[model samples]
Target: GESVGLHLPTLSVQEGDNSIINCAYSNSASDYFIWYKQESGKGPQFIIDIRSNMDKRQGQRVTVLLNKTVKHLSLQIAATQPGDSAVYFCAERPGNMLTFGGGTRLMVKP
Candidate 1:
């Protein structure tokens, strides 16, 4: 089974800091990986994505690094802000379906 789950659901960070969220995946063959940020009551929005062929990908203020050797993945947020506080989840396309990670909640402190 190819599933992604977070080690923690809630993370607290100062208004102007950096945050790192971790995720564990169950499949090494999953070719497509995506990081999504979900606010309070909305659907997950795409932040960044990486393919099996690559080990790293970056976006505006986000970076996704994948380690297929251990089937592990991580997301790093630079300059964490209040608006950057949200739930982050990872999804992988294993077969025809997308398996999503449990999700990590981030809290920004001022």
Candidate 2:
């Protein structure tokens, strides 16, 4: 996954509303995760993500939450905007392997 310091991707919402994107992995040992935002033609841009030790992390307008019990991950964006329009996906690191998820398109209305 992009969590390996590598790729690319968003969710749709109103300009002033909050957006949440989620992912689930089968491996419980996955310790590191990353959230990526990929624009139309660009590679995935790292938004906010971190190690498994923390239950939650916040970056700028984005927040990431990890639920190890269910092996789930989520991203929360506050006050989403048109510029935030893009594709979003998550990558989790299980040992030396990086797994990426299918991305969701984020379209923000004016």
Candidate 3:
């Protein structure tokens, strides 16, 4: 079976603050998880990744927390800015295939 969908997106926050988004997955065998950010009319850019063997990983101004038991992941962005406003996606890379979740839009109030 195939898995993918589209949904409305909206996130508004004050500038220089932080933001967090959540995701849920159905596949338990998935091993790798990645967070990506995409701007208007662009492809998803890699932000960070975490393996199923671990529970947490952090990157510049970003952190990813994974819960293997629940099949969930989350991304935290520090110092949200106007330039940071964009759509964020979470992808699960199992084997040679990459499965993407519907993105969430982030808005930074200036």
Displacement of the residue 15 alpha carbon in candidate 1, Å: 1.3
* Worst 10 contiguous positions by lDDT, candidate 1: 1-10
**Which digits, one per residue and each the tens of the lDDT, describe model 2 over residues 1-110?**
23321112344578899988878766667779988888988999999877989999999999999888877788889998888988887888777866778787888999
- Per-residue lDDT of candidate 3, residues 21-69 (tens digit): 8888777778898888999999888999999998999899999999888
Off by over 4 Å in 1: none
Candidate with the greatest TM-score versus the true structure: 1
Model 1, total clashes: 1
TM-score of each: 0.94, 0.86, 0.90
Screening candidate 3 with a backbone cut-off below 3 angstroms (N, C-alpha, C), the clashing residue pairs are: none
In the predicted model 1, the residue pairs found to clash are: 9-105
> Which regions of candidate 2 fall more than 4 Å away from where they truly are?
1-10
lDDT of each: 0.89, 0.79, 0.83
- The CA lDDT at 88 in model 2 is 86
The top-ranked prediction according to lDDT is: 1
- Candidate 1, lDDT over the whole model: 0.89
Candidates 1 and 2, the one with greater lDDT: 1
